[model samples]
Target: MSNRLLTYNPETEGAEGGLLIMGAPTRAAQPQPSTELEELELGSAFLEATSTSELASVVNRILRHGALLAGKPIASQVVQHLGARLNRAGQSVRTLLAPPAGRSDTAPSEAMERITGAELEGLSDEDKEFETARAFVRFAMEAGRLAARAPSTQPPAAVATAAARVAARRHAPGLDFVQLVPGFRARRAIRRQSFA
Candidate 1:
C-alpha cells in the first residue's frame, strides 16, 4: 500500500517480491467560465479610463458575473480581498473587521461569520485579511481587461457647481423689460405727452 490513506490489510495474501497495491486518487473537476462573466471583459477603452474606485466596482461586478462565478459569493470575496490588502499595508484586520463600540449588529458580527466558513477557522485574522486584499488586487488588475467600455469623463460636482454659478452670474445684472416689450416704450411716451 503506497497511499497514506491505505495500509496493508491482511484480507488478501501478499506474495514476497510482488507488486504493491496503491490507492487511485480522484481529482475534483475544474470550474468552467460562463457567458455573463465573459461579457464583463475590460476593453482597451475601459483600461485607460478606470480609477481605483472603478476598478473596485469591477471587482464587485465579477461576483454577479455569472452562475459559475456567482457561486464564489461577494461578501466572502470582498472580506478576503480587503483583509489581505490591510495586512500587506502593515495594517491590522481588526481595524477593518472589528465592530465599532456599543454596536451589536455590525458587519463583523453578521457578515464575517458567513464568509469565513468552517475551514478557514484556523487562519489568523491578519492572514485572512491578507488573502482578501490579495484577491481584491488581483480582481482589480484583471478587471481592466474585462471592462466593456471606458469610464465617463464627466467633471466633478465641485467643478460643475462652479460652472453653474459662473453662468448664473453672467445673466445676473437683469433683463431690460422696456426693450423686451415692442410697443411699451412708445405707449409710455404717448401717455407722458398727454399728461403734460
Candidate 2:
C-alpha cells in the first residue's frame, strides 16, 4: 500500500490496485486558488479579498487545510504575504500563536504579578501582553494587508504618550505647564489683530 494519504497515480486502476486509500487525508475539494494561505501569488487571485474579515477568513482556511507549498521561494513568499496582512491588521506574525511571555503551558492565568511588579500602575503586564497577542492574531487573520486609514487609537500607551510629547513640543510653552494651553498661536493672533 502507498504510504501517501492522498495518491494520484492515474495507472493505479482500482482502489485496491492503483491508489490504495490509506488514512483520511486532509485534502481540499480540488486545489482551487487558495483563498488565504495560497502559493503567495501577490497578483494572483488571493489579492481580491473585498473586506478585512474575508481576507482573514481565507488565510485561516488555508492554514486549516495545511496548504504548504514546497520550496523556500514559495514558503518565503507565503510568509511575506501573511506578514503583510497581519501588519495591516495591526499585528505581528511572530507573536500570533505565542502566549504571553510568562504564561503557563496548559491553563492561562490572569495573574499579573509575574508580568509586572508595580501594582499601582494602571497598565498591567497582562493587559499589554493580551493587546500585543490580539494585534498579532488580527494581523495574521487579515492576510497582512495594513489598513490605509489611521489606526483607531494607539494600541500601546507608550505610543500615545510619545504622541503627547510630540504635540507638547510643537506648541509653545504653557502657563507654568499645568492645566494651560499653549499661548504661541494666541499671541500671534493678537499681534495680527493689533496690525489690522
Candidate 3:
C-alpha cells in the first residue's frame, strides 16, 4: 500500500521484483563531500552533536565523504562521540567519589602523593582509600618505586599493607565495584626475601 522505490533485475534472481527502499545507493546519494578539505569545512556541524540525531548526522557525513575516497570506511566519528560521552562520565564518577569539596581530576594524583609522603601505620578507613589510589598511581607514575621501597621498608609488611589498603577501598562508599588486584603480586616474594 505504501509507495517506495522498487527494483527489477533478470540477471540476479531470474526476473524477480524487489522493493529497494533504503539501499547503499540511497545512503551514498546524500551529497557528501569528495575531499578532506571539504570535510574540514564542516567542523562545527561535526563537533556540535548534543543528541543522537545530530551525532548520527556527523557519522553519516563522515561515512559518505570516506566512501568517495578509496572506498574506505570512516568509523572514527562514532568513536569520537563515544569518547566525549565517556569523558563526561569519568569526570562525574571522579567528582562523586572524591572527598567532600575536593576536586574531581586532581584528587587521584593528590591522594597518591599523600600516601607516599605519610607514615603507613596509623591511617584510618578514609585514609585507606586515598592510600590505595596513591599506591596505584605511585606504582604507575614511578616504574619501580614499590619494588625499590618494599625491600628496604620490609616486603611482607608492605604487601600486607597494600593488600589491606585494597580491601579497605573495596568497602568504601561510592567505590563498591572497583577492586584493586595488585597485578604485581609476583614481585612480593622478591620483596619479602630482599627485605628479610
Candidate 4:
C-alpha cells in the first residue's frame, strides 16, 4: 500500500462517503510546522492552488482548515482567488458579475458595477460560465463574509461546466473525504452542478 496517510472512509456502510473524489491520489504526509509563522503560512496552502479547476479541493481544504481555525478562512481565499479571476475575466464575464453589497469583496462589487450599468441582454456560453462561477464564489463567501453557512456552503476554483457521472452524498458530520479532485472532476465530470 502507499505510504501516504490513510484517512478511513466507510463507503457502502452509509450514503455519505460518496462525496469523496473517486481515485484521488493520497496526499503525501508533511512535517508539522515548527514555528508559529510557519504554521500560519502552511494554513493557507489551499488558497495557493493555481487554477479555477482546483476549486473543490481548494474549497474543501479551506473547510477543513475552518475546523482547525474555528472560522471560514477558506471562504475568503475563494473570494480572493475568484476575485482575481473576475478582475482579469473577459469583458463578457465582467459584464455578468452582479454588484455585491456594501460589505462585499471588491471583485464582486466591481463585477456588480458593470452588470447593473450595462444592458447585458445576451452573453456567450463562456460568459455564463464566468457568471455561474462568480455566483458560486459569492455563495461560498458567506462562510467568511457572514460567518454562516449556506445550503451550498462551499468554496474552490475552476467550477466545472461539463456533466460527469458522479455519485455524490452529503458531507459526513465529523470527517471529510477527498475523492476525485475538482480539477480532475471538472475535466471529466458529466453533470451541471459538480462539487467536491
Candidate 5:
C-alpha cells in the first residue's frame, strides 16, 4: 500500500480553513434604472398634460414614486402642503391665461405686472401652459429632494417655500414671480382673499 500526503496550501486556503479559489469570476451586479431618464419621461408627461387635473395626477404619481424609491412613505400633511402650493401655482397660471375682471383690454393686475413686467401679456396660451408645466415639474423635483430628508427636520411650510423658490427660479430667472406663483409669506397676506 502506498501512503498519500495531504497539503494545506496557504494561497488556496483562508485563515479560517475556508477554501479561497483564485481566478474565479464573480457575478456582475444588475444595473439600476437611470433617474435622469425617469425625470425626462416625467417632464414629457407633464408637458403633454391637457388639464390642471391631469398635471396634478402626474405630480402625485411622481411624488409617490419618489417616496417609494426613498423607502419612506410620504406623510399626508406633506402631501397637503404640496397640494396647497400647487393650487397656488395653478391659480397663478389661470390668472395669467385670463386677464383680471373688468380689465379685459388691459394687462394683468398691477401686482402681476410688477412681478413679470410687460412679458406677462405677451405669452400665448401655449407658452403659458408650457411655463406652468415646467414650473410644476421643477417644484415636484425640489419637493422630492426635501421629502427625502427626515420629515421632522423641517416644517411643511418651510419645505413648500423652499421648493416653490426653486420652481420660481426655473419659471422666470431673476424675477420676483415666486410671490405670484407660490405666494410666499410676504405676498400671501396680500393675496389671501384672491386665493380663497
Candidate 6:
C-alpha cells in the first residue's frame, strides 16, 4: 500500500513533467522607469521651449501627466487650477516681452513683471531661461501646496464612524461571549441572605 502511494502515476505525472521540460524560457523582470528620470526629461523639454506659448504648452502637458499619474479627480482640479496660472504667467511673459500699445515699455506694471523677476527685453538668453525656470519652480511649489490641501475621499462622518468601530472592538475584549450567548449578561446579579 505504501509502495502504491509512493509510486508516481504516469498518466498524471507524465504531462506535468513534459510541460516542465517543454516550457518557454522565462525572461528577467524589467525595472520600472524612475520618476526622477521623467522629471529630468520634462525639465529639459521645458528649458528648450522657445516661446511663452510653447512654455505654457509644455507646462500643461506636465500638469496633465501629473494628474493622470495621481489617478484622482482632485488631481484633475489641481491641474485645471495650475493650468490657468500657467496661462496667465505665459501671458505676463508675452506682455513683458512686448508692452501693449498704450502702456509705456519703460514702466511695466509690477503685477505684470512679478512673474518674471527681470525684464525680458535686454536679458541674455541664459538669464531669461533662469527667470522662466524660477517662475516654474514657484508654480510647482504652489501646486504642491494645493495638492497637500486636497480633501479626503471619505466623508468626515464616515471617518468618525470607522474610528468609533475600531475603538469599540479594541476596548471590548469579551464582547464575543455576550454576543454568542443570548441569555448571558455582562453583569452578574448578587443575592444577599439576612441572618435570623
**Cα-based lDDT for every prediction:** 0.30, 0.31, 0.34, 0.32, 0.51, 0.40
Better of 3 and 5 by TM-score: 5
**Over 4 Å off in model 3, which ranges?**
1-36, 71-196
Q: After superposition, how far is residue 98 of candidate 3 from its true place, in Å?
A: 20
Clashes of each: 14, 11, 1, 17, 0, 0
Q: What are the per-residue Cα lDDT tens digits for candidate 6 across 1-196?
A: 6854454434323433321111221123222322655655665666667677787777666555543443433344445544554455444444454566897645543322344434566666555544544444334433332232234443322222222222222222222122222122311210111111
User: Per-residue lDDT of 70-170 in model 2, one digit per residue for the tens?
Assistant: 11121333444333333243222222224577857332222222222223135454454443333223223222111111022322222222222222222
| Predicted model with the maximum lDDT | 5
> Which one is best on TM-score?
5
Instruction: Give the runs in model 6 whose Cα sits over 4 Å from its true position.
Output: 1-56, 64-74, 98-105, 108-113, 116-126, 152-196
Off by over 4 Å in 5: 1-34, 68-71, 90-135, 166-196
For candidate 3, the C-alpha RMSD (Å) to the true structure equals 26.3
Tens digit of per-residue lDDT, candidate 1, span 20-122: 1111111223334444324334322123323445444444443344213323322343334332332222122133344468666444432333332223355
Residue 136 of model 4, lDDT score: 31
**Model 1 misses residue 159 by how many Å?**
25
Q: What shift in Å separates residue 99 of candidate 1 from its native position after superposition?
A: 3.3
lDDT for position 133 in model 2: 36
State the local distance difference test value for candidate 5. 0.51
Q: lDDT, candidate 4, residue 114?
A: 42
